[model samples]
Target: MPASIVEEFWRTQFATEPYRGGGFALTANPTLEEDRRAMLLVAADGTETAVVSPALAGVTATDAASFRAASAEAGARLHDPDLVHYLAADDRIGEETGHDIRLLTSADEDAFAAFEAGASEQDLDDAYVELDHWAVVGAFDGDELVCAASAYPWDDTQLADLGVLTLESHRGRGIARRVVRALAGEIIARGYEPQYRCQVDNAASIALARRAGFEVYGTWEPVSPDQ
Candidate 1:
């Protein structure tokens, strides 16, 4: 319930998806065709477990302290405590921005690289998280990529994840917002819902998602150090 915990959870999802920090585990991907499991983590008391991912096979605790002790005892093999509080944004929402953003694929490596540069390698690896179930979009300023977004391909039961980044020098032009909306629009067209989640403390990102027509569905908690 604490905002700090909420921010931690969202950051975990961010680190795993667009960044690939290897701090979390993968539950579902195109490669493993089991069942589409809920990525949301829940505590034993029915409270939404914060920071921990549902993909974790062992260890369960509701409170931050218990989970951390168990998680660490297990060699940190559990979900990152900082992963809770990530709010899934709605992809069904749309924006009226008229940017020239469009989808990009493997063939667009150059463009991806342009976006990848100065980005976390963890992101490059997990970029597939979106590609596996979302369409990736890139905004080009002439030949250079300035912004990007990805749409969800899964069902409403699944959470639609969105990530956007702007070239440092190109910030404040609303390019990130345009690309996010463009990708989210595509997801909606596919009959899937889109969700926007960002760190609670990331005022810039939270503002962008809000302006782009996304509302916070729920918040997850993060593991606390002293917990």
Candidate 2:
């Protein structure tokens, strides 16, 4: 897809102004959070747009003055802040290891339960309730699910947003990476681009995305009302 098309898709999805490449654009209705009320998009060159949804309208710093004013506002805070990474199907690197990785379905409730133990409540809901829209994959250590990954279709587009989680005990064992590779491969086979999103402070997730050959493309900072 063209860069312009990608930008338009995001802008429309968030109900924001047409992205003009650089600087910041503000929108009243952020698609991710119904209660966020306002959003800000920052782009380095103009092709990649980073989303920042503050609880209030004038919160995020577009320039300097707005930022300070936002900071002074009462009950202002950041939420769901993350960096977005895009990976082309052809650019995906890594081999599927011998680990027992398989597609997850509702029948695999036990495995799903184990996987959910490592994921956030919101993610668990997205993975299960919307199971039809996601390609779920799980890695098992014997009978125990050590890691899980899901590729969510992005707004009916040919793009898949990848989310992965691993049991605490399975950290550093490359299980997450393996599961991601398998899931990404499946996504590619289905004719879609895979995207990896990581929180700005999540060092492990960042490292894993890089190792999996996903290049940093953009960033998103979405704030919620409760914050």
The pairs that clash in candidate 2 are 21-46
lDDT tens digits, residue span 1-227, model 1 = 22233344334453332222223332322221122112334322333432333444465654545655665664443333212222243224445455657787777777666566756666445333333335778888787777777655323344456666666677888787778777767766664455565555667767887667665534443332342
Off by over 4 Å in 2: 1-8, 11-37, 43-80, 88-95, 115-133
* Candidates' C-alpha lDDT: 0.52, 0.63
Provide C-alpha RMSD values for all models, in order. 10.2, 5.3
Compared with the true structure, model 1 gives a TM-score of 0.54
Candidate 2: residue 85 Cα off by (Å): 1.1
Return the TM-score for each candidate structure. Answer: 0.54, 0.66
For model 2 the local lDDT of residue 106 reads 80
Residues 64-177, candidate 2: write the lDDT tens digits: 236434633634444555677766435644558767888888888876665666667864553232334479888888888777888788758877888887767778888777
- Local distance difference test, candidate 2: 0.63
